[model samples]
Target: MELRHLRYFTVVAETGGFGRAARMLHVAQSAISEQIRDLERELGVSLFNRENRRVRLTHEGEQFLEDARTVLDAANRAVTNMQRSQRGELGKLTVGFFVGGMGPFFSSIIREFRRVYPGIQVSLVEMAPGMQYQALQAGSIDVSFTRALPAIHASQLRSEPLRNEPFYAVLLRTHPLARKKTISIRELSEETFVLNDRRYSPAVFDKVITLCTEAGFSPKIGATGSVSSGVIALVEAGEGVAILPQGSRILSSSDIVWIPLSDKDAVIDMVLAWSPKLEQPALRSFLELVRRRRKQVGI
Candidate 1:
């Protein structure tokens, strides 16, 4: 039988009369009586015993009532869950972040998002800038916290500058310039540089080379690491010094020192990038939260 038939039958049983059930349901009494009769004929069982002015449930009616209530409850819950998902209040969001930085800012945004939408599950993946871009294009990740590279121009992708900060020189604690508050880019002319692979972050690699060249000498490249953490590890091992975004300072070890760069133009932009085609309600909710938190923190 149809859900309306079951509903009418339940209401009739509850009110103990078709007249009252019709009044409660805002329907004609004859309509309610006809629906109940149709339900009984379909089920081949009488659901109610009608007296002069009252009604009572038969044995089969009691058993079917509980099952019908269970079905209706489940159906209601399903509808509610679907609506919540559509509203961006429930689901999973996969976010990508660069391996070296994004610790503080990313963590803060995620914490605030979790507070606001606890029903949405957030998962983090550590990827290089290039990999993050690829993941976004391939639908593997919802959004990414990465650097803006000149070579990474995509019509379907959008990038918003989240934070811009100057680069810092990461040096071994035993290095002579480690004690300095600030070091000029020219001072590193004689020092070997630990660089990140260009494929991993082309913008950072090109910026470092440009800065060194502008300082009147080519950077003596000692070694290249695939990621920022690896570059820091090399610096800690005294392989060479490296210049990284200010946020990279959080990844510093006790054996390494972070000194500000003297060059004013030596800066990098930390960006939030995503594909417009993949914008789901959950991702939109997250983007809105990011904007709100960024404004609150004056980022």
Candidate 2:
């Protein structure tokens, strides 16, 4: 039978009379009586014993009342949970990041988001810039924090620049230029330059090349690593010098020294990228939080 049938049966059972149930439900007594009769016919069981002035529930009616209440309670809870999900109050959000992605600023934003939406499950996946873009496009990750890539020209994806910081020259401690507080990109023309593979971050690789070219010399490619950390390790092993984002100083090594680049163009942009096609309440809430955080910091 329908939910209304169960409700009408329960109300009549509780009130002990058709007239009282109808009045409580704001319906005609005759309407309640007809619905109850319909319920009994559907169930093939008499639910109530009607007397001249009183009504009493039969054995089957008493048993059915408990099940009806349970079913209604579960239905109500399901509706509430659906509403919560739609409002971005609860769900899972998969976030992608590259090496050194947990810089102070990015980590702070994540902390604040967790504080605000504790019900949303946030998980992190470490990937290169190229892989992050691919994952985002493939719907494997919800959003990503990565360096702005020139190769990511997908129309379905949107990127928002969050931070722009200069690059630093990473060199072996024994190198004479390592002692300098800052150096121009032109001074490194004679040295072998270690760089991460273009597949890791084409934008960063291209930026380094452009900066060196603008300084009247193309970078002498001495070595290449798959990721930023690997490039740093290669530098530590004296493979060659490399340029890295300023924030990468946090991944320092005793054998390596980070010297700031004098060229203003030797910089990298950190951005948040996501696919517009997969818009959802949780993603929207997170993007809004990012905007609010950026405003608070005057970024």
Candidate 3:
């Protein structure tokens, strides 16, 4: 009926005597005998044959022992797994990240985490900064690599700056400015700026506007792309130039040139964001690992 009942039943059956099981379990012989009697009454079967000094299992006891051992083994494993999960050694960790925003440290951090906590399962979801914040608040994601958390979420979440990324000008190879080693934000004032759609990624949209405004001109909006690839495609079509983070260089091509911005404020901050109440053990372990390697990763 209970785990202890199964445990005592198996121990007594293995030792072949009430006295021996009692000694092995550090209980009185009378107590072990009483427990065995209770077990037999509950199951309505005599589990042991009463021999003078030693006991042998009845036909029913031999069959029950197999199931009893299985149940005990499963119960033991359950307890061990629960303890490991609580200690941040086992469980699943879901991470949300920007499509191209995770900098150099992201891959290294993940590699180290997987190495150190092999028992923990890791999942990655690519999301925009706004979407990442929403997922964090809804508890769908444990942690996120994001940029520009909106003021509305400032009170609900906690974040740490993981990387400060500089902006670059993405232009068609034939564009005159593409020939320049570095371009200032002011130089892009007259050029149509293709930007990520404000609805999907307001932070990037707003930051681009701010940079242009700070450079003494309001950028002419040429088009908007709902996705990063869409933005790149539009730029490749020569619709307009784009101001993107340095990480966007990975999408570079012979037709598209990525020139660093010379403006002093041409930078954006990439942060590791999460809910203040992180209850998952695996999430805590991941955050700790990131902290330990922050200096080494140059973040």
- TM-scores for all candidates: the values are 0.89, 0.91, 0.95
lDDT of each: 0.87, 0.87, 0.87
Tell me the tens digit of each residue's lDDT in model 2 across 1-299.
78788788889988999889989999999998999999989889888887557899889988988888898788788898799889998888999987675577678878988899998999989888878888888889999998885654557689899988789999999998979999998999999999979988787888899899899998889899888888999999888899988766767889999999988787788999998998789998999999998898898
Give Cα distance to truth, residue 149, candidate 3, Å.
Answer: 1.3
Candidate 2, clashing residue pairs? none
Among all windows of 10 consecutive residues in model 3, the one with the lowest summed lDDT is 246-255
Scored against the true structure, residue 55 in model 1 reaches a CA lDDT of 86
Tell me the deviation in Å of residue 19 in model 3: 1.1
Which of the two candidates, 1 or 2, achieves a greater TM-score against the reference?
Answer: 2
Per residue, candidate 3 scores C-alpha lDDT tens digits across 63-152 of 999999999999999999999999999999999987688666888888889999999999999887778888998989999988867788
Candidate 1 has its poorest 10 consecutive residues by lDDT at 148-157
